[model samples]
Target: MDYKLIDNTEGKQYEYHIDGVIAKIEYIRAKDKIYLTHTEVPKELEGQGVASALVKDVLNDIEKKELTLIPMCPFVASYIKRHPDWKKLVLKGINIA
Candidate 1:
């Protein structure tokens, strides 16, 4: 299993390769703050925790950069909601509505 985070200009994404298959992809962005916008893992990669791994990897980069985040993606929002430890990293005064 190989996991890597790549920034595709508009945002960052986590890419995972397993058994020579590209298994997962996640979209992320950093504007006034970082925003994780979308995520998808191939059906074969479901239940393998690939999405979680990608999210965690992106979050780690956010922390390392000392950047705040606004999780706009539903999955990312739910992930942040569940992980209170990352709340402090959320951007201040963000308007998601």
Candidate 2:
């Protein structure tokens, strides 16, 4: 599925809209690390890969910015575990598993 990811800095979240529902990955920025705190996908959007797309785009954005991450959300951690390349984006000394 095609996806558009937006970093709503004012809202401190990355959001994507699909089928009229908004999927978001919320985070808190501290020092040089972004703590990925939660992920929410509307029920209508579930099983459609919205959450996967949201997390993938968010990880790409963080990589582009050369920022580290603490993926506190279980979904995000699982994504990183399944896609090891993105694991490099995790902040040093931080463990999410």
Best by lDDT: 2
Per-residue lDDT tens digits for candidate 2, residues 2-78, read: 78898999999999977777899999998788999999999888798889988999999999988899989999999
Tell me which residue pairs clash in candidate 2: none
**Any runs in candidate 1 off by more than 4 Å, and if so which?**
8-12, 23-32, 93-97
Q: For model 1, how does the per-residue alpha-carbon lDDT over 32-89 read when each residue is reduced to its tens digit?
A: 5666667787788789788877777778877987878877777766777777687778
Q: Give TM per candidate.
A: 0.73, 0.93
lDDT of 2: 0.89
Give the lDDT of residue 5 in candidate 2. 91
> How many steric overlaps are in each model, in order?
0, 0
Candidate 1 total steric clashes:
0
